[model samples]
Target: MANKIILTGGGSAGHVTVNIALLPELTKRGWNMVYIGSEDGIERELMTPYTNVPYYAIKTGKLRRYFDWKNFKDPFKVITGAYQAYDIIRKEKPQVVFSKGGFVSVPVVIGAWLNRTPIIIHESDVTPGLANRIAIPFATKVCTTFEETSAHVPSQKVEYIGAVIREELLQGSAIKGRNTLFFTRSKPTLLVMGGSLGSKRLNEVIRDSLPLLLQEFHIIHICGKGQVDETLTHQAYRQFEYVTDELPDFLATADLIISRAGSNAIFEFLTLQKPMILIPLPTSSSRGDQIVNAASFQKNGYAEVIPDEQVTKDRLVQTVHQVYEQRSIYMGNMQKVKKRDPLLAIIQLIEKTALSDRSRNKKEK
Candidate 1:
């Protein structure tokens, strides 16, 4: 039988991208992968393009840090998800479980733990998210993008694998990107993106500052799904709901970028040597993880962090100019970062986990 593995994580593109990065390596080693995620999440939409990967959806509930009526009801959903996951685990009997730390993965991790499967989780933030924090004890190994993140988790369980960047992203073409979008100018390309869901704040500021921005750069704004404003039809500005296959070229064409401080996104930018201005999610809405991520980038001169209070039309315009002016300094710093091939290391860890299972099985026989 092929070495089988269960990969679980969803709710956002970040959770799915890490798994996508590992899929090629896993397939090369002849591992059959099953994905367990929420029934109607972005994961399903994202994974739909993969014909070989069988997907299974189960019940899932969020674990909120704050009070809500759903708090009581969600636990039952979690229990239901756990039971569903347990059944899937029993049937799949995967050699190991690798979770990417979303709400849906909690039950899958629990189910895998119940089945005596080794669990590995990769966390992309400097601090563990709520789901990963809850899933930690069950995990045999915890992979992190930042070394500082390991300080919060069990030291023995941690390994710093850096970020898992998709190989396709490394192959983006500036010329192809510009030509595809009909960018005919000598001006720089400014790429603006919020997270996968899109950021209302970032969108508003970018749209507000566009009159000043478009004068200097050929702008490509991935203004989130449904967040596109049809009223702004400037020839120099292009807005996309999102790009799947064309993102690499689009990224390659970018001279400067504006984005949220998601670990995977920023790391990809750093790897590409793009000077960026990161507007992290406000702490009131999150655990302040993005702030920590943006701060680290600033500390290392990889990117500039724009404070929430400073996120306005004027400020956005000023910051964009500043980043454009100081682009070389930021690029120089990003170039200094020692890049690691997380896909290889993660695949090795995943394969190692499966190999041990075979050893134990043989010994038992």
Candidate 2:
């Protein structure tokens, strides 16, 4: 019988992309893959293109740090989700469950543990998010993109595999990207992105700085959904609510990037050797994971960082010029870092864990 695996994660693009990256390879190896996620989530939309992979939706409540009225009611929803997940796992009888950290993953992990199924979860940030932290004890192995994360989680379960970049991203064509955007080769191209939901502050600052920036470079701004300013249009400026298929091309064409300090995104930029200016989400709005991610990248000479609170029109323009000027230095530092095949590493671990589970089951029988 073929090895079967249940994949779970959602709530944001970051939680889903790693699992997306794993799909092609797992499919090629003849693994039967199923996905369990929230009923309505970005994961559902992103996974729609994969007809072969069966998708199961379950109820999930947002795992929030701050207190809210919903806090009282969410535990019941989570309990329902856990029961639903347990039923699915019982029926599917997968050898292992692989999770990318998100709110939906908690119940799935709990279910997997209840079924005595081995579980593996990936953590992309410097520290485990609330979802991952809750699921860690149940996981057979916890893969991390940052080595420093070991101190925060169970050291025995931690596997520092580094970033698992999507294969397609490395195949992007700069020429194709430039042609699609009608961008010329004479000027540098600056790509700005503020994560999946988009950053209001980033959108406002970038729009405000466009006039000065457009003089030096062609700009592609992924301003997030419903964040576009329809009133302002420029010959050298292009705005997108989001880009799915065209993202690789855009990355290829970019000479420099100004983006939020999400770990997965920054690692992709680093892999592509794109110099960056990072604006981490402020601690007030977040648990400050992005701030730590940005600081790590800056320390490694891979990027520059501006605190979210300090981002201004003038500051953004100045940083753009500074990063563009020092682009080679940043690229050089990125090149100096040794590369590892994290995708393969994670796959090997999954296969190993699955085989062990199968062996133990057989021995007991």
Candidate 3:
């Protein structure tokens, strides 16, 4: 019989990318998989086409951290999500639930708990988010991408697993050959990304500074497709509005990267052993989680953090220059951080949990 499994969480690529990184391993191991996500999320578009697995979407929204009148409605949504999840759990009866923390996962986690399903939650950031923090109490096994997360979690149940980066990142090709569009002067190339929907603020900063940056180094910017138009094409930038599958080629070519401090992107760079410049979204961000994440990586020397106030043209140029001049320092510090083949670890965890569930079932029978 198939060992049933369900995966949840999707507000950003940080939450969705974990499943992408692990799907190959799950498929190779022949485990049956189901996905639980929000109806309006990118997961429905990304995961459904790739896997022939059961996927269910729940109605969900984030509860504001600050006082807002709309905050009153969140409790009702939580109740509605729980009911939706209850139906999914009853129909699928998954043996184990793996969640990447997000608002959408709250309902699934609660429903799984009520059904007595084994729960595993993975926090991909240096700190746990609100959903994962709440879910930690009930999670049978809690996994984290960063060691520092244990402090805020207040749970002895947590396990520190290196970030589960997409498998391709771990096996990146060695830096070699002449400078390409993404690299110039064989001086490390820095990749700047703002996530799938893209960051207008980051894009504007890059636009302001790119004219100077291009003279000294090569850059490959993943300007979100939504931002692409005749106006940007006229800019003197070697950029990609869209390149889905060849993303590995771009990363393999980069020597350094400038990116937002999304846990998924940061870990991807870590896995590739590339130096990073992280700009957490400013204080006014909707979630305010990226600022905390960026600071944690900076504290540990995994990357350097540049506050939005200091993201001027001069600062951007100076920061890139400083890191390039001291390339060895950044690369050396990154070594202290861990990198591994997460495919094996995920497979082992799933198989172990699945077998344990089957054994318990036999005993009950």
Q: Find the 10 residues in a row with the least total lDDT in model 1.
A: 333-342
Off by over 4 Å in 3: 170-188, 233-236, 241-243, 286-288, 336-339
Pairs clashing within candidate 3: 190-256, 191-257
Candidate 1 C-alpha lDDT tens digits along 1-365:
89899999999999999998888888888889999999999999999987788999999998898999999999988889999999999999999999998899999999999988899999999999999999999999999999898789998999899999999999999999999999975899999999899888888888878888989999999978999899989878999988899999999999999999999999999889999999999888888989999999999998888987679888888888998999999888887888688888899888888888779878989
Task: List, residue by residue over 1-365, the lDDT tens digit for candidate 3.
Answer: 67778999888767888887777778776778899998888777778677577779898867668888878888788889988998899889888898987889998899899887888888887667788887888888777777777886656677777778776655544343223342345444567787777877788888888778877666677878677534554222556665556677678877778888888888778767778888888777646667888888787777888987678778888888877777688778888765565556666776777778778978999
Error of 2 at 259 (Å): 0.5
Is 1 or 2 the stronger prediction by TM-score?
2
Sort by lDDT, top down from the best: 2, 1, 3
Q: What is the C-alpha lDDT of each candidate?
A: 0.91, 0.94, 0.77
| lDDT for residue 270 in candidate 2, whole number 0-100 | 96
* Cα distance off (Å), candidate 1, residue 189: 0.5
The TM-scores of all predictions, comma-separated, are 0.98, 0.99, 0.90
Clash pairs for candidate 1: none
Q: Please write out the lDDT profile of model 2 over residues 1-365, one tens digit for every residue.
A: 99999999998899999999999999999999999999999999999999999999999888889989999998888899999999999999999999998999999999999999999999999988999989998999999999899898787898999999999999999999999999999899999999999999999999888889989999999999999899988878899999999999999999999999988999999999999999999989999999999999999999999999999999889989999999999999999989899999999999999999989999999
Q: Give candidate 1's whole-model lDDT.
A: 0.91
Model 2: lDDT of residue 125: 93
Clashes of each: 0, 0, 2
